[model samples]
Target: MSTNKVIHALYNDDDILMDAVKKVRAEHHHIEEVFTPFPVHGLDKALGLAPTRLAITAFLYGITGTAVSTWLTWYTMIADWPQDIGGKPSFSWLENMPAFVPILFELTVFFAAHLMVITFFMRSRLWPFKEAENPDPRTTDDHFLMEIPVEGNEDELKALLESTGAVEINVVEKH
Candidate 1:
């Protein structure tokens, strides 16, 4: 559980809020989190957060899916249950391989998509059948919020927020 008290600053304009965040980070160096209704360009650069790992995970998942699908199809069709068709010899790996390509492609796509979605949700802390923890409902609709954790000098923090053109400010004790 977190014990830091957070001060929330709400802004209607994302550009102003982004500037405020950069200013606050430059001045205070104690921002906890910022929440916005939608993706704001250049916000991640301003925050100095590392680039996302989703793409890497997705690529690995795609490779795994492709390999698994290919191996499974080959093993089942050629190795395990070899059946002669159209007077062609059974167990001819190259000859029967084309027939597995469609199913292989489908499985690869399916696994890549589904696994990437799972990875995204897990990494983002978002999941189906889970309640959202949106601090302000408006933060989901229109407002952008910057949450700065107060470290004994809240007055200065409040001043910094005000200087950044925060439309509203609220402080809550986190116990």
Candidate 2:
């Protein structure tokens, strides 16, 4: 597969970068990705990207994990191993719920954390031994990069980047 041509821009100000992003998006709706050195608030809204649902999934997984842990503990300790320890009631599942709550909570958090991490990794295609595709090394250090796939007028895009107060511009070819 042929990778798309990426035009990289380095910006110093967030407001300028935001304005540039708006202009680029308004004039041409073909921007592939934008990278910032620091977190820019409301950037996602500017990019028209939807809010993520990972927190919701994590909560649901936590609840499921809690339920499973509770059921398993109750079944094993109350139903299967019904031995009265210290003359306590053998079939007291509800009374001894407090004793098993810590384990249940821990398991729930563990499952939620692990499952959410896995979900994020799988969804983002990030895994072990995966090579990162970074257009410029400086982008991660201190410069913001706005990447546009070169599909139409190259001069117009270059002019747009220059007009947006980009300090530097570089055209990257895909392998």
Candidate 3:
């Protein structure tokens, strides 16, 4: 239930769009979002967004994977049935830990990668069969779009958009 109106400014090139972002931020106007044809370097910084903490989450996931692997190895190899691996069997997991290193590394990487993807999807509101929220389809192909919530001064916003070299500007009302 958004009753706000937004100004969608389209840019022909990412370079120009980036400059527009800087100018808009400098004025203290709130930019709702920006869509780009491709990844633009420093766009996040220009938008004043906080850096992502996914790496930290991934590290935690890796540690969980490591603990799981350790438990599984100890239960299966040492507790249930003990056997000589590489002719070095003291009937203990510590003696056979060298052989488990590869398994630990693989499981850690697997958990980190899969959990990171899932976390990204959940955070972004992206899921299977979910309709995309792209403001303009052209942004996916060759254009960039910046969505700015309109306050009272629509004329001033339009003028600023023009000076920033936006190819097209549209004022849309959303319910």
Best by TM-score: 3
What is the per-residue lDDT of model 1 for residues 123-146, given as tens digits with 9 covering 90 to 100?
Answer: 778977888777889999999998
lDDT, candidate 2, 13-108, per-residue tens: 788889988988888556678887779998888887889999899999999899889988889889988877767676888887877888898999
Clashes of each: 0, 0, 0
Worst 10 residues of 2 by lDDT: 28-37
Against the hidden reference, what TM-scores do the models get?
A: 0.90, 0.91, 0.95
Quantify all predictions' global Cα lDDT against the true fold.
0.85, 0.84, 0.91
What global local distance difference test value does model 3 have?
0.91
- Give me candidate 1's TM-score against the actual structure: 0.90
Top lDDT model? 3
What is residue 66's positional error in candidate 1, in angstroms? 1.1
**What stretches of model 3 exceed 4 Å from their correct place?**
none
TM-score of 2: 0.91
**Between the candidate structures 2 and 3, which one is better when assessed by TM-score?**
3
